[model samples]
Target: MLRQNLQQKLLQKLSPQQIQFIKLLQVPTVALDTRIKEELEENPALEDPSLMTADEPVSEYDDLNERDDYDSEAKEDTSTDEFNVEDYLQDDNTNDYSTSYNNGDDDEEKKETPIAIESTFFESLQEQLDLVPLSDTDFIVGKQIIGSLDDDGYLRRPITSMIDDLAFSQNVIVEEEDVHEMLKVIQSFDPPGIAASDLQECLTLQLKRKDVNNPIIKKAISIVEHHLDEFTRKHYDKLEKSVGLNSEELKEVVAEILRLNPKPGDSNQVTTKQLQIIPDFHISNNDGILILTLNSKNAPELRVSRSYMDMFDHYDKAAQKDKKLKEAVQFVKQKLDSAKWFIDAIKQRQQTLLKTMNAIMHYQYEYFLTADERKMRPMILKDIADKIGMDISTVSRVANSKYVQTEFGTFLLKSFFSEAIQTENGEEVSNKEVKKILEDCIGNEDKRRPLADEKLTEILKERGYNIARRTVAKYREQMNIPVARLRKEL
Candidate 1:
């Protein structure tokens, strides 16, 4: 014999409508229009306000007022409750719903213009290669070498592997010497560093193209060729001893080396078509007060079709009840419900976006007003989420892809959030402030003797910012600034 025990539990889950709103909230303004267009195409019951006439009535089935007869027949046949057509035919006019913003702008005038295309880096190289004078085998080998180059214009593949490729793929047996000759020809192409195999080679190629008679140019080339390791490590003493140059002369050589392009292929790299960023919110500073406005393009005029509403009402009053008529009514009800749910989701998305952004704007109010990044306070997603009474995930979704235009400049919303760091006075400040101070210190330090992380930490402590040497190094790396040794000059 088996016994069963009674157990009860409660569970929470998101409905379809809630999930829909969450997805829409994460979509940026630039892509929201396309999303709405897709919904309009899929749902026949949905319609744009511009497509409907002004004088059109909300419902055509209003004349079919037979509620009393339908009720009495429902009572006689209790099974009719299983298919209650009256529930869907209620007098709710979704036609009155408008998705347009109050600012009044025509929807037909907004459109995206096509962008022009440009030639890629490889295509330009191939065109240049066509003009070179070479025999058929040499031309094929040269083309193979060019194809092996990466986006940075460096030939990362080994010559031995390329030789194998030529023998198997092209049915041509070529020696390492022949490949090297072709590579030399490619290195002499338009871009000074186009076919260099490494950073040292790239820099040497560029420096060789400069005035050969200049002592500084020759010294620079020698430094890149022989003393490259010492130069990179900022071992100025070693470089001066090896190159036989005085302090002032080494400075000139260092300056010349710094001017050469380390990555030559970057100059001819194909440019990508930049996407236009349409800010979702605009914050204007007026008389020291910041006012936020949502972008008008986000709000499009949308409505449920009046004809669909009228057809549902007509089916409800039909004297002859049939299977086909019931199916048709059910289909119309689904479409209508979906249309209403979508409109509601859009409204909810707008509200959530505004609420989250407003909280962030006010939280960083001082920074926005003065355009001083130092004024920004320590803030995180949790801070805004708590203020707006929403989940942290919701706040993150809103901040991740959204852009805002301010009196200062257009910035990504996510850039405003930063982790907190405590000062010597037990006060909390944004890490951005610490980074800004570090940037200034690095910028003003004597290039002859750059400050190391330990010294940087001491300086920061003197200014009331209590941070460790490791943390200072972390922040410096985040800013893409090299270590003191690499930053050292003459």
Candidate 2:
């Protein structure tokens, strides 16, 4: 014998529409257009309203509740394993698939902007290599060496490893001397230090390209080749004693070395092809009031296809209904439902973005108005979430990738949120203010005797910040500032 127990429990789950809305809400303005285009391609029933003619009649089943009777009847009749084609033959114009929103008369037509293409870094190098006269084997070996260069233009792989690669991959047997000669030729290519193995080689290669008769260039080469360690540690006195140079001559030698590129490949790097930032919101200070406007490019006008609705209407009134026709009508209905859900989700995403950003704008109103980062108040994701009556995760999704343009500058929304720190007077201030103070202190200190974390802590305490030495070090590292020892200069 077996016994069963009865229990009741509650569960929560996201509906398909809710999940879709969440994904759309997280997409920033720059990517929303591409997402919409993908949706358009995937669903034929979905269309851009601007592409439809002005005479296209509006859809009849625009309201979602209009299909309740047909849906209920379909659900009731579809329970059996067999289907009767005659069941859907009756004329039902009101049950046709349609969209909820109509195209506005004032909506302007959208046009796509074309992007220009540019050659990549490797392509430019290959072009230069073509001009070099060499045997086929030498050329292949040279190509392999160029291919082995990292984005920083350094050949990190060992010569022995490359020799094996050439023999195994290219079926070419060559000695270390051949590879070295080809490397020397490549290093002579444009952009002074194209195939250097390390920073020292890179600097030396560039100095050799300059006039060798110049005494300063020769001295700089000697310093880089010999006293590089001492020069890096700013052991200038040791370098002067070793190189037999006076103080003024040592300065000139150091200056020449500093002018050479440590990472030569960075100069030819194609950074101009980077994607431009598209700000999600624009905030303007009109006299004393701050106005927020979402970028219109994000919110596209989408609607159900009028021809699909008309076809569904025509099929509903057909006297001789077939299995194929019923299947076609069902497909149309499904597509129409998807289009309506997508349009609704886009609208909800717009509302949520505005709500979250409005709360942030007001929360940091003082900083935005004054264009002074120190004026920013202490705020966290929860504070805005509570203000706008949404979950912290929802607020975080909006802030993570979104940007806002103000009179001061365009800034990432997440950058405005900082933890609170109490001052000596028991007043709460943004940790950003403390970081700014620390940065100022380090910038003004005599680099010959840079301030340590303990000294920084004392300075903050004198200014009523009451911060600790460890906290000061943490903030300094967060700002990418090195320790006192690394910051010292001669």
Candidate 3:
């Protein structure tokens, strides 16, 4: 059983450097600066080229000088020679040698303190809580409850459970009613419906806060609470007959109901608006041609520090005379090498991102220009990989967490790629396009007698899209559109 086994097997494996390169390729230009700063702080080998000097000898620093081909302003310091890559390699096997580029250079020694802002949800909530006039116990309880509330601001756990947890964990005996009272106070906080027990309660709470005088709204709440089945099933005819309301009246009620805020907690989380998707690359339309420009603001100009490089050069040159100087040089070299890898990683990331996005833009040129779902053609990871001559996994990595802003809207890079479906006219269209058409058809349909999947399929065929009934049904469900019978209203 323990005998040496040899078998021919095909496998695809990536080294640490290769994996790092792929990751760096996807990072957009705007984020690249922060990423660089982080690297400078972590790696001693990395230096800021802005701080280079005439005294530093960079001739012997061959490895770093080669990277200078990208941004040549910064010179390498060739002073102390003792510090080298081998020392750091031997000192810590666990440390990623490439990740140590923390500080930039000796000249730019002092780092300006960053202005801290409210970044956490709880921090924002606590700040808002300070503005309120609740009792100390209530505030303490509220803070705990607020902390427990997720990004959506839903109090997921039961009050009794939380009360028990508090009593047991904090050794503070608190009644369930006290927790419940505090929760109600929190629910009244800026988010309007933060501490509701369930979806129905959440919606109802927000609706009740409104001073609108509409019996339809009152009935809508009743319907959502008790006759939710009737509302969801769209058994409007029966419900109308029972509730004594006609079709037009029901539509008016539905419209008002639609206007109510579903996620009140989201209203206060305004920081998301600040997160701008600074496109890593810009593609403009020229005279019947597409022009591409890499957004340079996002891409930083960086170089190794001259002082660091000079120290190493001097140490190396004077190693015969001074042993201490040689060790200092060795240390600086180790830090600088790390710094170089980080800078290299940053450069590599930009190239990969550009290459992948360019390929995608070309692949779905119509969709990028128009921003219409119908214009989107069927594309896959394999298709892009083939186009870019890169591995499918590499393409996938580029697609993941990457976004592109277009004239139409900002969308995740991966959303443009979908499987193709054949139309009755023997032409191919994206499944996404088909879904869009299906949604449009549903939105404009007669609620009195909603079209079934079979009917929808027939309609598509009439429009030159040859799709099966099951496919139509699948698309409907995927779009969150109900069944024909369920979709029918009064």
User: Each model's TM-score?
Assistant: 0.84, 0.83, 0.69
- lDDT of the candidates, in the order given: 0.83, 0.81, 0.68
Residues 1-490, candidate 2, lDDT per residue (tens digit)? 9999999999999999999999998888888989989999999877776556999755544432244435455544544514333332223332221222222232441433455566556777888889999999889989999899998888999999999999999899999999999999889887887789888989999999999899989888899999899898788888889988988899899888878877766766767656767788889898978988777765666666665665565565455779999899788777767876787788788788889999999999888888887999999999999999999999999999899988878889999999999998999999999999999999999987899999999999999999889999999999999999778765
| Candidates 1 and 3, the one with greater TM-score | 1
How far in Å is the alpha carbon of 423 misplaced in model 3? 3.8
By lDDT, highest first, what's the ranking? Answer: 1, 2, 3
Residue-wise C-alpha lDDT for candidate 3, range 1-490, written one tens digit per residue: 6899789999989876676676676665456567667776776455544344778653444544344332222122221323442332221213222232222342452344344464455666777888888776677778779878866767788777777767778666778889987777777766566667677787777767666466877877766677666776777777777677787988876676667666666665645345546555556666536655555443454555555664554455452647776567667766776666655676666566778888998888876666678998899999999987888988887787677665556667778789998876678889998899889988999988888888889888898888889888888887788788877655
* Decreasing TM-score order of the candidates: 1, 2, 3
Per-residue alpha-carbon lDDT of candidate 1 for residues 279-310, written as tens digits (9 for 90 to 100) = 89989889999988788766666766666866
lDDT of 1: 0.83
Candidate whose TM-score is highest: 1
What's the count of clashing pairs in each model shown? 0, 0, 51
Off by over 4 Å in 3: 1-16, 28-30, 49-195, 200-225, 267-276, 319-330, 366-375, 424-426, 477-490
What lDDT would candidate 2 get against the real structure? 0.81
Q: Is candidate 2 or candidate 3 better by TM-score?
A: 2
